[model samples]
Target chain A: MSTVAVMNGNYAAATAARLARPEVIAAYPITPQTPVVEYLTLFAAEGSLSSRMTEVESEHSAMSILSGASLAGARCYTATSSQGLALMYEPYFRASTLRLPIVMNIVNREMISPQSVWGGPQDSLTLRDAGWIQIYVEDNQEILDQTIQAFRIAEDPRVLLPINVCYDGFYLSHMTERVEVPEQAEIDAFLPPYEAKHQILDPRKPMAIDPLTSGYLVMEYRKKHMDSMAAALGVVEETDKAYAALTGRSWGGALDLYRMEDAEYAVVTLGSVTGACREMVDEKRAAGVRIGLVKVRCLRPFPKAAVAAALARVKGFGVIDRNVSFGWNTGIVYQEVRSALYESGRTLPSVPFVGGLGGEDITLGLVSKAFDEIVAAVDAGRTPQSAVWLWAPRKGVKA
Target chain B: MSALDLLAEREDMISPGISACVGCNVELTLRTVMKVLGPNSILAIPPGCMGGVGVVGWNKQSGAKVPVFFPLLDNTASMLAGIRLALDAKGRDAHVVAFAGDGATVDAGFQALSGVAERGDRIIYICYDNEGYMNTGYQRSSSTSKGSWTSTTPVSKEGQGGKRQHGKDFPMIMAMHDVPYVATASPAYIPDLVRKVEEAMKVKEGLAYIHVYNPCLTGWGIRAEESISVARLAVKTRFFPLYEARNRKFKITVPVPNPLPLEDYTSRIKKFSHLGPERIAELKDLAEERYRFLEAVSAGGGGRA
Candidate 1:
């Protein structure tokens, strides 16, 4: 096992790409994503990794380059964020619909308009309908680890679709952390080379990849994407087990539950907030408070079964979303969770807490406050409203 | 990825099931583009004429058997850049090309295209300039030459003076990027057009632009058979000069030969027939201004080598 240190999130991502050994990497770096291309270029120049890097002109071109490469049966990857991700929305959906196992790393950033460069889930959340399997990472290590795992999950012939590995910009991207740098041989043994089954760029077996389809055909194509997404749950679980065997670290397939057994209260969260909530739960448990934390690692598959089981015995459940779905009075994830539990015939009071919109911090103090509200509501024989706003400080307070 | 290979493969690669107009320049442009790009080419088209016309479905165009990526009109360049990165991840090299109309390239996609070109990405951007937005009806576009009449600029009761702006100088604008290659060609001169495409393909790196002056016979109110004649007149009258820019060096490929009077060229098209003395003078002045700008560039006046 050799050790290689990277300075920034971009460098971390590039190192992951090198270790993952992607065959084709097409990308155009925008703002935060530029460092990724810079490091990849350096890697390619130094011949540390054997990969072909196409320096495209824009984020849109970068995504399109992958569409062709993936369809041609090459293991493909790319990175972008904010307006750049918005620019790539069109093909983002197409990549998923065509079931191309292309992996993308989105350095989550807020969209421009009174423009800000801070970290947020705005970019990846906006593309929820693009048919890509999106996973949120809380730290640099998760960013590196999830990125390597994304290819395995996405390229599983059973679940052939694109994946977006998202991490908070500036926070997780620039912050330094101790990431377990896996050896190349271990990675090679864990994840096999991408072997496309039906689509290929070989002149010997020619095929037209993206042809126009009628409305009916379009519906069926989308249905297929959904079906495959559902199939990914099992694949993710299996892959997690396989990866665990290789790395000796176990990450949950759909949801990572921390100290949930015998707990009466649970907090549903994703990304970096999960880490803060985990700490709070541990502290709360020591004080004899029946509190636990459930971190959602996979967002696309919805993890309905796993979520239901996690919330099965909990008395009061609350969901914290970094993104808001206006008019729903709840975050999009809250809505999905409610629907999943409702369909599973489970009767429980789940409160929706919308916070951290546009890159606001999700502090442990906020998690404690949310728990207090839940406990007080439960004690007072009330479940509070269907949705609640958390950490919305008074006017003049900086987010 | 040579022009000749692209031309030779057109018949076999691109099938003929598209919904393009019977005499559409876009069809010809797509045919030529796919032929030269070879089999490993990824085609990213927008929701415009080319997307709607080039390949409708699997059985539609059997001509070029390659991967075709269709994105929304405004996102072609940006999406292509992403595709290039993904391809690079696999350690396999592939060419990515964006083929869009003048409206898609110069108007709706201007910012994204400019950003892409500025970065010097390794992809070829080809604009099939057919003067107007023909797919959405014959609407006048920025690329529409002065005094040309379209549905928006229909013939006035007095029968003179329609639209009055010179076509946007996109090739000149692209030269500012100092990209690896830039050229102008027309289907009327297939061999020359193919030669430029061949040269652009060989670079294999950095941004390349090829602006073709494709004539819309239906929009121009000319007989389908007069497509070549109209194109030749455009070149002869110096309205659309042919040239190439490489490594910041501008070289005029087809110089004005025995330049014909502007009236002789304008007399043949109904769109230009309404032009009176004053409007004709305006058109001539615009053409002369364009000619001088290009001539200056060719002589190394525009920061080019």
Candidate 2:
């Protein structure tokens, strides 16, 4: 039996990790992600979490510790946010390349320059190509559910790679929502204890890991890593179906569609902004406008087929990105969506929308405005060359 | 058993032939240390002389009989800590160890090592301090001695400039962390080094760190035949004293009561050839001051039981 409890996103992530029963957990504290580490340590202190927890000095050590633990055939977990993620980049990339099944919750916060720490997916999106399977969640429940499923997907023999379950900071990380905490027995039944087969650092077995390799062997390792990533797409869907069957709740595999069928236009979104977009989709439908919402859940090993197929029947679509793709003049996901469309041999009228940066709210008003632009582009049969900024001028403030 | 008998009887964990430079005492230190650690050990060889010489191996070949791997240069201690935790989780009793160089230890890898000490992670860390980044063409590291001429701290055409600062006292720093074991060993004193390694293995409660002072033959521009002698001079000159601290209780393992003149050690290495009388005297005074401090700590019992 599962217990439904009201908890914030960080607690939800921590609860999911506890249920998974990772053999080792090491994490350092960072804003937004700080509470997750606190909750985990608290669980360990209370004797509920039996994992050997290390209060690591830095995010670098946190990832390094997990990498070592995973290599030693132990299931491991950790959590971090913006700057912490940047600090762990070296070990983070190595974790995936080494193919360690470590699950990390990325409490997504914006990268600093103007120095804001509220909320954004820019942190994880900037590292989309770093080889970790990244899954962005919409709410606290999704945060709990996906983090639990993350272990299963990462430890799958066909897809033995590190994974990141990313959720927007403050928006979901601090926001309270009802979450279904799974029972220990249920989680044990779902995610079997991780058994390392490919590589392990054991004295009894005695084998070299990550030796100085020739260029040819390095290339072979990279090719195998890529193949595993491609294989993970299927594993993600299968795990989602299995979890849904056990829990009666399924976050759509890679891309979750809301009223996508029989709709002429769609607005694509990622992370917490999906909630506001979903409401706008319904609002537009009630006003007799045929529109739907496409929420991108899995960002790495991108669900190109599902995304292209979902947008196939629509006349046009608009992507709302909280993160920018510097040289492209649009958002990161907008470029990704366009690239996927190009690969599918389809060029339709589309609008690129960029807003909600540095944790500024992507309000219902902004999402509705984005949908209007998509509808306008589809009716006019002309795609905009530049991004449509979803900006709202505040009272007594200049644009 | 005597240290010599133990060494002779124990199986060498490191592979016989790889590619360490001729007469590299760091290689000697690693082989001797691993023999003490034996087969029930998981070793982390970070990027340095040992790793570059293929201690962790090239391609599919392994450089050690025990499980060995190359940890990131700055993460050896934390990685070993993880290995320890995992091994404990699986109810396996194995020595989790790291054989790294000074560049990977006192410089980039210090924080992870210090954190492990503070956290009481049951792992053994052995740092082969050959003064500088020898594998990368003798760049200056924090562990490089004062007045030494590294590639990064090069002397001028007039032989006026060298390293401006003194090398960091790293072993003392680990001792201050009050871990279960902290020791400074030397390649010249095989018995002492062997005993320290054995002592480290006996530490089941917390981190056991052994810092070995090895004079680099290739990097320090010393004759290959003079490698062990030069390392001996370092100890005789009181520049790198052999000592150990168990839970803050300090003891000089191989005490040098009548130290040799600093020139005896400095004159042997080309990196310190540029040092004049005043500079050499400064080094002598500094070593004396450090030794006096160690004496005080040893006499005072490090302020705690």
**Per-model TM-score on C-alpha atoms:** 0.87, 0.98
Off by over 4 Å in 2: A395-398, B300-305
TM-score of the first chain in candidate 2 relative to the native first chain: 0.98
* Docking quality class, candidate 2: high
Interface RMSD (Å), each candidate?
A: 4.3, 0.7
lDDT of 1: 0.76
Identify the candidate with maximal TM-score: 2
lDDT of each: 0.76, 0.92
**Per-chain TM-score (chain B), model 1:** 0.89
What DockQ results do all the predictions give, each relative to the true complex? 0.33, 0.84
Compose the digit string of candidate 1's lDDT tens values, residues B168-207: 8888888888788999887777777877877888876678
Tens-place lDDT per residue, model 1, A251-297, is 78788888889889888888777888888888888888898888888
lDDT of 2 by residue, B1-305 (tens): 88899889999888899799998898889989988888988999999999999889889989999999989999999999898888888888898999999999999999999999999999999999998999989999998888899999999989888899999999999999999999999999999999999999999899999999999999899999998999999999889988899987888877778899989999999999989999999999999999878877883442222
Model 2 residue A396 CA deviation in Å: 6.3
